[model samples]
Target: MKTVAFVPIKLNSQRLPHKNILPFGDKPLCWHVINELINVKQIDEVYVYCSDEKIINYIPKEAKFLKRNPNLDGDLVKGFDIYKSFIDTVGADIYVLAHTTSPFLKSSTISSALLKMIESNYDSAFSAKKVQTFAWFDNKPINYDLNDIPRTQDIEPIYVETSGFFMFKQDVFTKHQRRIGFNPYIQEIDEYEAVDIDTKEDYEFALKLIKTLNENGREQHV
Candidate 1:
């Protein structure tokens, strides 16, 4: 039914200061995600939640802007609380949580995830990357044991939440107080699409990857 995409952004960042407004490929970093969400046909509306008023200049006219709570503006504030605030204010049947860090995320992927959630009767859906490589924990092999080493292809794939985007029914948040519910679906995306800009190194890597992809004539779906 009715779905809305929310892009939560803040002015302060610990690792990469002022990263949300940093210069990305063509425009500011967050603009890429904002524009993508606005273009998605499945989404009825797109909202930009930010504390800074200056961000208004970057967001397109098609999207709406909402001021974030100043109390939740600190770096130590939990993201779950911020999301709860959004839910409490802007009511929607389905909410699509997206991040500016994932600049390469595509509108088609967002639409696909939402469609899958509806068709499959999933309470929630999130973007993830399929991981099949060997993993270790507590100084021991996790997926494979030293005694038995199997081919990588034979190993079962694990899905890692990319935090790129999430689609969930409002009831999911009301019941679990979180974006993900008990019956959640994971939409697998490629590693490149899952890239999250947290640090300077990550930003550089993403820029380089974007440049390389463009050079190869690969059109970025977003």
Candidate 2:
């Protein structure tokens, strides 16, 4: 089956302004995930959907580039719209949605998720991180209560969508109008790989983590 990976990027970020082009490791932040996608053997093609021409220079020649619609450039624009636009314009049997913020995501993880989704006949698969800690909602206890608090280890794990990556068939998106389908598989990833840079502190933390990983000769895992 033909698979295409899409990395949606915009120059303007509300929390961290111009974060996509920020210096990260050896190159721009977005390049980290972009390059990772290019290395995925399961992906037949990689594309960057962005409004900024400045990013064109950084994108590798092997990946295709498509300019996003101006109307959809605003921060308030819904992500579903952008995704649907891409599906309509650039057709593919399977689509992989990868985020630039998830710089630590490994190519192996991407390949593994795709393999599982295809082999298991799952409609969709998304990268997530498992959390076993107590949770709360609206002042009420969730996953735990004061009356009978379960040990952290014994607590049922809750998977939090890390937005690291999403693999889905074109029909899944057509039916749900979302990246996730009715029957979706949660592909758990390590905490390090789930790091998403959305703020200044997150960016700094990622940089430090990258430095530490490199110093320990573990950069290849990224």
- Compute the lDDT of residue 77 as modeled in candidate 2: 90
lDDT of 1 by residue, 1-222 (tens): 788889998888889998988888878898988888887888898999888888898777898999987888897899898999888998888999999999988888888888888788798999999999898879987787779888999976677899799888998897878788878888889877899999999999988998899899898943
Instruction: Give candidate 2 misplaced runs (Cα > 4 Å).
Output: none
- Write down the lDDT of every candidate, Cα atoms only: 0.87, 0.88
Q: Model 1 off-target regions past 4 Å?
A: none
Which candidate has the top score in lDDT?
2
Clashes of 1: 0
